[model samples]
Target: MKLISLLFIILLRFDGTTASLVKESSDKNTVYVCGSGKGKRYHLNENCRGLKSCSAKTIKTTREQAQKEGKTLCGWED
Candidate 1:
């Protein structure tokens, strides 16, 4: 009983750690967008379907700057 509980706790801890790591990794690979509507950051190659339309000039900007532009821009991989 004690050993089973210990194992369960360990498993739960490991699961939490894995979840956090996954989130962090995903965030690291993402680009942030600011301006227009609520303004939010998105991952590379993710669709920007509903956001405000952006121009080619905005698309050419660095990921961080693009985020500040607040317009729909294609992800780097796109």
Candidate 2:
């Protein structure tokens, strides 16, 4: 039916817009890291399991700086 098709298109468009909004809201530029492993693991949240066992200090830094130092997303957080 034409109505069904139109509804589908509208739903699809709305879903896409909602997804973009969620992504924008969750945009985490700041990362938490422990001073170890050559800066290889960075977490978007401080409570990530990857940092739970960390004995060193958990410092906050930007994602760009973490990447520049060869850090990757923490397995537990991302």
Error of 1 at 17 (Å): 7.9
TM-score, cand. 1: 0.21
Candidate 2, residue 25: lDDT: 41
lDDT by residue (1-78, candidate 2, tens digit) is: 999988866676579875554454477787888976555799887768888888888997889999988889988766
Q: Candidate 1 lDDT, tens digit per residue, 1-78?
A: 999988866676579875554554456435534333344433343234523354322122256665565544444434
Best candidate according to lDDT:
2
Q: What is the lDDT of candidate 1?
A: 0.47
TM-score of each: 0.21, 0.60
